[model samples]
Target: MSKPVLTIFYQFNPWDSSIGGIQTVIRSFIKYAPDEFVVRVVGTGAPGSALGVWKWTEYAGKAIQFMPVIAVGEDNVRKLIPTTIAYGASLMRHNFASDFMHFHRIEPTLASLNWAGDKTLFIHNDIRKQMDRNLGGKAILWQQFPKVYFALEKLLISQFEQVYSCNSESAQHYREAYPELAPRVAFLKNGFDPESFYPDKREEREIKRRELAQELGLPETVRFLLFAGRLHPQKDPVLGIQAIAALADPQVHLLIAGAGELEEQVRREIQALNLGDRVTLLGAVNSDRLAQLYRAASAFLLSSVYEGLPVTVLEALACGTPVVTTDCGETPKLLSPDSGVVCKERTAEAIADALRRVLANPDLYSSEACVRTVQPYSAPSIVQEVYRQMLHRWQYRKAIAISSPYPS
Candidate 1:
């Protein structure tokens, strides 16, 4: 018998490791897939005037096809409409010849409404909550559309054979939204690459911290409160700066490692708040550099208005750095008093208070304790379970196809 082929879809440059947590999870799935399965990855790229060809690539030493659809857009929201149409058109034109299709996020799933085969959806965030929080600016113009759009999206959700959420909180939310399909929803938490993120020795960490300060042009005595995510409305980069301003601690600095549409706005806020010396935007850094930042930082800060289980939180914990985040996603459940702090509110004051508690007693949240907290979420272990589940589903489908009296 041939190995079951699994086509994984995500509407972004999947090869770009710096994109965010979603890419990390996708890469993990590809990297740790079992020998009995063949996984193919599909992503979007600039329009090449014609459809691009599938190129076989070696990812984590496994041979797989890297297919790109010629669909381009400027930003996340803008990319949705074009990517959705492009994916639907691509599916219509090409036969992936796979036993199963796994989609990340809503757009691709929306495009696959006509697919009658074994398919699954990965929910990375609380969709309803995220839409509600991000419905501002020009989004207010089409405010009524989301109500009807998501109503249709709910119907789309019912079409999937299985749905995996990044956190239990989001899993529960989706279950409540679609009561009849509640049994199909499951929580599959995110994990960090243990090889890429881990605690550095005390002597080595101090040396790296000094080197980082010299590279970023900061004082040798400065302590970093790192924020690593896209500077979008979802992450609320401005809130992080506000929290830093509220802290009013000269020895502490906020280092933002990612950039997005809010870049100019973030710069303006830094200047307006007179936090130029206290805040540094490093733009986007690769996985190695990010791991170093996690090692050197005093604490990882996340001020998002909402989230699913954020991979940054897991990476920070894996790197032996405690996280100080607003109460969102699975932070409250994932973090313990000794490992990290979960803020009671989303306000700057609340975040500042949490930072104060972590910064004041650094020894209380020991590196060993922090690392211990996320050991259960090791990539190898988590991805193994993911592959096992996929194989089981594939086997069940095969059994049905073999026993059925009618053609599949």
Candidate 2:
């Protein structure tokens, strides 16, 4: 008997040049996907280097039948409509062959929802919450658009056979939106690559600390509080800076990594706040370098106003580094006496208080504890869970084939 086929549709190709937690999740998941399933991936916005006619290639040590859609230019809306049509056509052709299909981000889900097969929708964030947040600040048309969008979102979600939420909060939002479909909405959380992210030996960890200090021309005595993510509004990078300044501790240095439209704004605030000496901006660093910083830093920090579980926080926990984060996604659930701390209020003073407390007792949060808490969230464990769920669903459909199949 041959392995069952599982097709995945994603908004962006992980093979293409990209950054962020979503892309990282796709790449990492593919790397650890079970051999029990034959994998096929359909993605959009592939760079020229990755474009091929259904390329059969190996990436991250996994065999994948790859298909990518080319964009005309930089207009995302212009490219998106066509990408959806193209991928949707492919899904229709592969519908019979594939045992099931899974979608990564929203655009792909919306585009390929017409496929008549066992499919799962992965929800990265609450679209309604985002629209609610933006309506007040956007143009007049946008002010009235979110309410309309909320209705459309509910309708679209009702069409899906399954919806995968990364955290309990998101799951609750979906369950509330369509109580009738509550059982169809499932929780499959995000995690980290345990092999690549682990605590270094105490001496080696200190060496990386000294190395980072020397490379950045900083004093070895200073403690670095690391924050790695796109410098976007939702990330609340400015609030993170304000929180650091509130501490007013000269011995603590803040390291901000990742880049985005808000980079200039963050830079200006750094200058205005006289944080130039205490804050270091690292535009972007590869996974290995990021892991090094994780091991070297005193603690990781993220002040996002909202999120659907962040991969960065998981990476930090895997590196055995404590984190100080706003209460977004599963950060609150993941926190404990030995794991890290959270600022539920999302205020500078609240974050400062939490940071101060974590900094006050360095040894209270042990590296072993940090690693242990995140063990269940490792790549291998998550991969197994996804495989089991998809397989079980596939078998259930087969058993029900004799009866009138459930309507879409």
Candidate 3:
């Protein structure tokens, strides 16, 4: 007999891009899926033969497929709506063939909701709400957008046989926002690949450290503090820069490695603070380079005002680097006194203090302990749990039908 089909609808491609947490999660999922299920992914991209899809099919007897939806121009709005509708219509045609539809992000979930199919939706982040709040002075205009988006979120979630959230906070928010659907919501934390991110050997670490330092024109004595994510208003990279400035520790250098809409603004702030000599903005670093950076850094810092659950922190911990993060999203649950510092206040002073403390006392947490804490969050482990829960729910429903008096 053939394995069951599990179709995933995502607005973006993990293999084609290096965008933050979402891409990381999807790539890890593909890398570690079980052998009993066939995975097919549908994503959106630029129109025509110029656009191509990537497929990975090496997992035992399981198969993987990528179907791309081509768009017309640079303006995403012109492409998004039509591509989404087309994708949904196509999936509706094959509804009876698949066992389940799994949506990795919101837009696709909204698109797949009305289709005559069984589905599951994963709430990666409360992105629409985050965007509304981050838009600041334009909040009135964008705030209304989230209200509509959340309404759609609620509606789509209701249509799903099961809804999975990346963190407990999102689960609680969904429960509070829509009490009627609380029972269907389940928590499925994101995971990492230990082999890909685990600590490097001492020789490897030293070599990478020296090479990176020389390449970036850094003095051998300087200790680098790293932040790896988009420099957007939501991530608040300015806060990380300001925190370093507040410390006034010349030995501590800030290395930012990502891009976003606020790139120019972040550059302006660096110039204003006369931090050109102390900060290095590496634009965007690839996965291997990012892993090397994590191994070389004194600590990893995240200053986001909100998040679902950042995979970078897990990656950093897996690489044996301690983390200093704000109490954003599910971070507090992940951080213990043994792993890293979690700040209650979202200010430069608070972050600076946390960074200073972690730097001054690195041995307070054992790297091995930190790595062990995140073992349960590995990609294979998390995916296995997802499969178990899904199967259990399916069996329960089957049992109910078998016991019902009206059943054939």
Q: Model 3: runs farther than 4 Å from truth?
A: 46-63, 71-97, 126-144, 201-204, 391-408
**What TM-score would candidate 2 get against the native?**
0.86
* Per-model TM-score versus the true fold: 0.91, 0.86, 0.85
lDDT of each: 0.81, 0.75, 0.73
**RMSD for each of the candidates:** 2.6, 4.1, 4.1
Per-residue error for 266 in candidate 2, Å, reads: 0.9
Q: lDDT tens string, model 2, 1-408?
A: 457787777656665444477777777768888888888877654345444357787878899987765532322122324444465454454433357777764443554556566777787754444455552232112335666656656656765678888877778888987899999988877879887899987788788888888898988888889999877666878999998889899888999878765778899998988999999988767788889899998899988877778889889989989989887777788777788987878789999898898888878877887888887788778867878887787777666764756653
Q: Which candidate, 1 or 3, would have the higher lDDT against the true structure?
A: 1
Residue 194 in candidate 1 has what lDDT?
89
Residue 80, candidate 2: C-alpha displacement in angstroms:
12
Minimal lDDT window, size 10, model 1 = 135-144
Q: Give the poorly placed runs of model 1, Cα more than 4 Å off.
A: 46-50, 71-97, 133-144, 399-408
Question: What is the Å distance of residue 202 in model 1 from its true position?
Answer: 2.2
Model 3, position 256: C-alpha lDDT score: 93
**Which 10 successive residues of model 3 have the least lDDT summed?**
71-80
Q: Number of the top candidate by TM-score?
A: 1
